[model samples]
Target: MTKLVLAADHGGFELKEIIKKFLAELGGYAVKDIGAYSAESVDYPEYGHKAAAAVASGQAERGIIFCGTGIGISIAANKTAGIRAANCVSEYMAEMSRSHNDANILALGGRIVEPELAKKIVKIWLDTPFAGGRHERRVKQIG
Candidate 1:
């Protein structure tokens, strides 16, 4: 089964929970929630780092991080070496991030993206495989 690590701040807590259930219902993945746990205020960086670390360390094959706008959390995740967290607002971006960039983490805007659209993006990101011919060399240069 595929393993996924998830994290979110207070602004993203609700959506994160929803996505967790959605992934669980899919039945082929082991979803780990690294948390902000509740809708109370929390820092995005903390959760982002936790999830990114799990992915970078190979505890999870992939990670999904969330913030109010998806930008700050992704930036935080990217600070960790070996983690490529892509903040995707569209299905096309999600697919491209995985296929072209080989992103190990996907970042979503809990407040900006509707739950349905987020789900579609998640599905696309997870289903797409990295096209690692020329892209492999490019990804290697990313340090």
Candidate 2:
């Protein structure tokens, strides 16, 4: 089973909860919410780091992060050595993040995209396989 880790700040906590349920019940993925569980103000970096590290250490296969703008949390996730985090607002970007970059973590803005779109992007991202071959070399160069 593929384990997915999710984390968010206060600004994105509600959306994170929605995504958590979507992933667990509808998507049928083993979901872990490493959270600011409620809508209380909190720092995203700490949770972002925990999500990224879980993936980097093989405790999880993928991660999702949320914040007001998705920028800070994405940046925080990318700081971890093995975490390739991408801030994706569309299904195309989500699909490409996996196909081209082999991104293990996806970042979404709570205030940016709607719930419907977020779920769609997640579906595409999770379904796509990394298009290795030449992409692998570039991904390695990025590392």
Candidate 3:
């Protein structure tokens, strides 16, 4: 089973809620919504770290992070060892993030993407598998 870990800051908290509901009921994956339970104006780094830790420790198979601009949270998640998190704004990039990099986490910009688009992106991301041939060596070197 694919275990997905999710977290967000105040800026993406609302979107995260919509995502959580969708994943639990319709996505056909195991989801763990870490926090930022409310849009109460908080820092993204803390939540990013928690989500990253889950992925890094193998507690979760993948992670989804949300922030005002996705850039910041993506940066934070990538800081943890063994995390190959990518911020994807398009369906192509979402697919590539998994196929080429074997990305363990996906980062989304709450203010930048719509709910339907986000859901679609998540589905695409989860469905793709790493190409894992010569790219395997490169991905291992990434961390």
Which candidate, 1 or 3, has the higher lDDT?
A: 1
- TM-score of model 2 vs. true structure: 0.97
RMSD to native, candidate 3? 1.0
Candidate 3 residue lDDT tens string, 40-68 = 99999998999999999989989999998
Model 3 regions more than 4 Å off: none
For model 2, residues 1-143, the per-residue Cα lDDT tens digits are 78988999987787898888888777568888888878888998998899999999988989999998788999999999978999999999999999999999999999888999999998899999999999999999988
* Each prediction's RMSD to truth: 0.6, 0.9, 1.0
Pairs clashing within candidate 3: none
Clashing pairs in 1: none
**Could you tell me the lDDT of residue 70 within candidate 1?**
95
Record all residue pairs in model 2 with backbone atoms less than 3 Å apart, i.e. clashing.
Answer: none
Clashes per candidate, residues 3 or more apart or on different chains: 0, 0, 0
Cα lDDT listed for each candidate = 0.94, 0.91, 0.91
For model 1, the superposed segments whose C-alpha errors exceed 4 Å read none
Model 2: residues with Cα > 4 Å off, grouped in runs: none
Best of the two (1, 2) by lDDT: 1
